[model samples]
Target: MNKTCPNCGALLIKDAWETVETNDNGSYVFKSYLALKCLQRCGYYERADQNDQE
Candidate 1:
């Protein structure tokens, strides 16, 4: 999947992030999600904290 850069209106590349997640039932599962970013060093990267990963 391609994404548009929010800063320069250019096309961005797609990437995936994987991590373990727990549901309300207390079951743990490995999940993946798509992320988008500019390849030309547009500084459009989104920040994630340690808490956000869990």
Candidate 2:
């Protein structure tokens, strides 16, 4: 799967460290292991973590 910026449809590359967060369900969630850059405009990126993969 390719990570892209929410603002712009730019491909996000793995530029930084990976971030993980634990939900209330006591399951660990992997947010993003990559950095997304917007070429046209600056925006936010939102994605859902796969519980099975985590």
Best by lDDT: 1
| Ten contiguous residues with the weakest lDDT in model 2 | 45-54
Clashing pairs in 1: none
How well is each residue in 1-54 modelled by candidate 1, as lDDT tens digits? Answer: 355778987776655557798999999999776655577768675433443333
**Residue-level lDDT for 16 in candidate 2:** 32
Tell me how many residue pairs clash in candidate 1.
Answer: 0
How many pairs in model 2 have backbone atoms within 3 A of each other, for residues 3 or more apart or on separate chains, i.e. clashes?
0
Q: Each candidate: what lDDT?
A: 0.64, 0.53
